[model samples]
Target: MIAAMLKVMVLGVCRDRGALAMAFVLPPLIFVVFAAIFSGTSGTEMRLKVAVVDEVRSDETTRLMDAIANEPSLRMHALANQSQQSLREAVAYGNADVGLIIAGALTQDGEQSPIVIVADAGRSMAGPILSGHVQRLIASQLPGVALRRLIPSVDMLSGGLTSQQRAQLISSTDEMNTADNSKSITVGESGAGLFRMEVLDGRGNVTVSYYAGAVAVMFLLFSAMQGAASLIEERSSGIMDRLAVGAAGTDVVVASKFLFLTLQGLLQVGLIFVIAWIVYDVALLPHLMPWLATTVFASAAAAGLALFMASACTSRQQANTISSFLVLVASAVGGSMVPRFMMPPWLQDIGWLTPNAWAIEAYQGALWRGENTWALLTFLWPLALVAVVSLLCAFALSRYRLRLG
Candidate 1:
């Protein structure tokens, strides 16, 4: 009886092709997906990739920039301009996440003063956390004008000048130095250019400003590939033939697949988030609005991806082989599995063209950019464009060929 039952079980499993595939593929797939998603920066808090545009060339700004750069909480990317727009654009284009705009006037003298912080509200991996650190550094360094005035007076008096006279003399000396070499002075403040970064690791752990691109790219690409799997199934089962028999037409069939794939995309996102929440303790509730915003793009991405798979192969086996290969290759290029920073400069340049790159960047925009839902309109609309393009292509294919595969 036991041998009969075992034989029956083996036959049932072999007969159910989908179940067989799922049983063999699902576990490893889930493991690889999550492993790629959550692997790294362990015990390290996410830092902002800040672009500091030092206009003043004062020792003060340099000190601040250097300090922030060295801070474990901020992976800084120094820029060439002080305007917020350029910094914001850097973040928007997936070049960097956060930035500092140091106006020339802000560091005219060797004074520890407040500088402009240009937070990329669209895709900062840790904007708030890094911003807080910046604020704290300023607060600690600059107590009050009256108080700071007293600490430095002891040195000025040694030069045999009164308080007002000493101030004038120091200012004059700094001006003269600037007139010689623009890079001669410290970056932002009046200190002699010596600076250090002080960051707390655990504090940054809750923030994750650094991992946005990594997670976004991996998961978005995963959704795309998974959605593409439906194409393989459709080709295998001969569903394309039955769809053409009705007046409902090819558009209807394609639309149904798109909708199905979109739903599947949502489920994939949900699964990743669930794993993240259960294990990594990343915030999902407070970030619900952004999550939804990301979901909008994911749906469109699913359509484009499914279309690609549907068109790429004539047989189910070929579709599976090509789709999986393309996904893995794209993910590698897009910085889904590895840090883009670690890859060669040319690879980084090429990565921008992949949808995986865009999705990752957009996700970063939502997760760490600290903007509300309304801000996502600009970030999300391109994904919809891709979706529309995919649907149009698939519709055209169906109209011309009357069947996919």
Candidate 2:
């Protein structure tokens, strides 16, 4: 009897192809995505987008900029004829992960450092990584600059080098600069001190603002999916058939569901942000208008996606399983689970396909970065497009494909 029951279970499991795929296929696929996202976090394989401005334009600055531009791990955008303000804007607007401004001579003058690293507080990790690369480049590519800067302090401390010592020191410095010392020299923390970091939009709680948007979009997708699953239940129970023939036909049912789910998502996101505001001081009240606009579009997109998933699936279980897989994958790639900058270049590019990325960016722009109306539109339109396209697709699948009435 036990063996017969076991056989029945095995056969039943094998017959359900969706369950089988969900149990076996999805784990490995999710592992691959997680591995791809986390594999480069150890700094060796990580790549950063750097926006550079050379204000000094001297030989040293040119050499340093050239070295940085050639670095394999960094994508450098040299903003020629641009100011430090432009670089700051680039970083603030997510055009670059970090900004580099060669504002003074490479050799330190008094207490001021020459290199400036401008970063958005939301992406705080990028600033230090860029600084490390700059320090390494200065030590390797222009060892003479390091040696020249050190010599002045040494001379002042040692009561000045004698004429003969000075001559020999000059010759040795030139030799050190000309020789291949890439493998021999290492820049320490003191060398890294040559960089000054200027972080933007750090007054508010940056982490809360960023992850609030992330969690909001993710849960919006999930809640919307759960609510939309009722369509499948209604279809199976003959409720949809009954509604199809009534004065309020299938169109009304679908439209009403869409409206309810959208509003539900909006309220859900509002509750999350309201808590964020009360607890973390996330500047919600200050940016209420743009924030509301972003929330509405994001909710509509979630509703549309959920409806489409429901309309396409034949069973509630299948819809749940598939929606879970898709939502998890989308959240992982779309800067919800992790910042998009942390992912590789390919994954970062793919993130644009997910509504989470657009919604998160729109919210961040509205709350954290204080982006202007025109700039916020760039992130808004994609979300609106997703909502429209998905809603249309859901309508078509329900009306024509399913033939409900």
Candidate 3:
């Protein structure tokens, strides 16, 4: 029975890519995704780096930060400059996973003193999880004194109990604690601009932040490898020389491949986005212009990379072998396979050199965060580097052909 079941399962997986991916890939991926979502209250225990923005300077704030510092779920780090802009950069650059800002104070009925709590929702799960823990800890410690004083006294005569017994019971219970305030408002200030800042929201920021970097990087590698395949195919068929026999030299031949592969990359990204929209319900065009611009650059970068790889390789098999290793390795390091948040700090720092890492960041920023084109800064440098590399590859290809002895 076991042997038969194994055979059936293998056959089933072999029949379909989606089924195979779902069976072999989806389970672990799903587990990781769920883990990211509901890991624990003490996110510090998971080793997340958090930044503190303390707008309210009080004992309560101190206690909250202290509790956070002691937690294993987080590594509370900070930008030396402590400005909002600096904090945003820290989060964006992967130096910090969560950002906590103690915005202001709040006061309740008949209380002159303002009770301030944490106000930021964080870039990662640590933000909200840490905020919740901080709030609970602060409420438990600070509200204990006030609740104790506010316990009401009920008349023993009305309850048919002896006055002494009733008084004794009330004293014992009152000794525990009471809550002066009932409602638990998470934020201490207005919720306007805060929600908009997160990289991936359902509206597109979060998904874009994650997916854009993910897709651009992943597909760019694939496109380049595919472009390299053409070189092998051309050599196999003698197409390179037929075109090179005319004024359409190797330069023109390489240019055409670059242009064609870029178009293919653009189409692939478009299809992926469309499928994501229909399947995952990711918002496609929140800020249409920036989103469109991101797609264009991502396609261009992919093509340039493909051209460079193709021009350098000796044959399709060699290009395929080399490009495959490059793509998989780059994708692994650059956050195509796993979330960058979970990687070690040093590794995350290294991922910055990859185009996928930056492209995903920009796509996500534009798609989800309502970020302007400036978010594309992370992408532009990598893309520009590829273009320069491709041009150099073109020059090298000319030299290789001139001496193809």
Candidate 4:
């Protein structure tokens, strides 16, 4: 029975170049786009654009600016003669990440003055990182120069302290800073330490993992929908009418489509992961079994869904529209577009209705979260159940529709 279904589907697919292209070409292209967008997030270096305005241009300020410019992480644009207003505008208008203005001289006096930093609230990390580097530079020049003044706002201090109290505070602050500076995290010879771990291991580009699942589920539905078009076409062209009267039953036709789409969906998903492994270096080999299991169940679920949609709709246009709408809505709610963690609690609970939610979760759990095959069955069984129920329903509906016609 399955062989007959496979022969028909294979012949149909081979005859249509467009269908073949969508099945093979589209998935790899989609994976490439996703990999390009997310491949750099987990790199060791953080490249930030910084704008500097040195009004004083003293030896101290020049040295400090030079030091900051030399850092590997920072890409500095020296606005040598530019005003502090220009620096502020640069950061405000997205021209630069963080801006520094050295308007006054770096005095070696006992009192500390604030160094102006131009930043917006949206990027909280850039400001603090820039400030830390600048403080380190200041410390190099003027030893024991209190970095407390580098805090973003003076309002953080509720009241003024006396000179003696302030001196004691500075001493405590200096001791704490020194203590922190003295220690560093490094890999040990045992090979189990933090530094020994691969930067890409377990923590590689999260965006890639997320989009891998998202695109897989999204296109699984698309390919299945496209495959299911055969049903609508056959029905409209009187082929289904002949088949209904012939020895072949409506149940056989539905079963054939379900099997065909399941196989194609599996191929589409497997090709996508292969691209992910080759292009993005995702850890596919270590968790191959879990991934394959997830793919099989996901493909089955998507196939059943496509058959159901095909049977339910009277026209090809209606089937396409309904399938497209359902796929997108499910993808959106199912953590295919956005991570479920970002979604509200109520929406997260509701995502389980969609096959995409289970498939994506299962893939993510196996590939990214290092989940075992058994652990993934929690999601796998539900997906298989959905496929079984949906395929049965589609067969019944197709039989009923054929009889009515």
User: How does candidate 2 fare on TM-score?
Assistant: 0.94
Highest-lDDT candidate = 2
What digit string (tens of lDDT, one per residue) describes model 4 on residues 1-405? 999999999998798665665577656755653343233222323456788887778665676677788866667865534887677655643456677766565543223332566654333356656766665554553333334332212224746566776677567645543452433222122211101111112433445765787799899998898898788888888888988878997888889989889889888988888888888877788889999999999999999989988898887866776676678667766768765433433455677888888988788678766677898998899999989998998998888888888
Give candidate 4's error at residue 394 in angstroms.
0.3
Instruction: Please give the lDDT score at residue 281 for candidate 3.
Output: 64
Ranking by TM-score: 2, 3, 1, 4
lDDT of 1 by residue, 251-331 (tens): 777777787777766776766666665666656666677777777576666566667667554555555655665666667
> What lDDT would each prediction earn against the true structure?
0.56, 0.85, 0.59, 0.69
Please provide TM-scores, in order, for all candidate models, with all chains considered together: 0.55, 0.94, 0.63, 0.53
In model 4, state the lDDT of residue 196: 12
Q: Candidate 4: lDDT over CA atoms?
A: 0.69
Model 2 misplaced regions, further than 4 Å: 78-81, 156-159, 163-171, 180-182
lDDT of model 3 at position 50: 80
Q: What is the lDDT of residue 93 in candidate 4?
A: 39
Deviation from truth (RMSD, Å), model 4 = 17.5
Residue 169 in candidate 1, Cα distance off native in Å: 21
Worst 10 residues of 2 by lDDT: 184-193
Q: List the residue pairs that clash in candidate 4.
A: none
Quick one: how many clashes does candidate 4 have?
A: 0
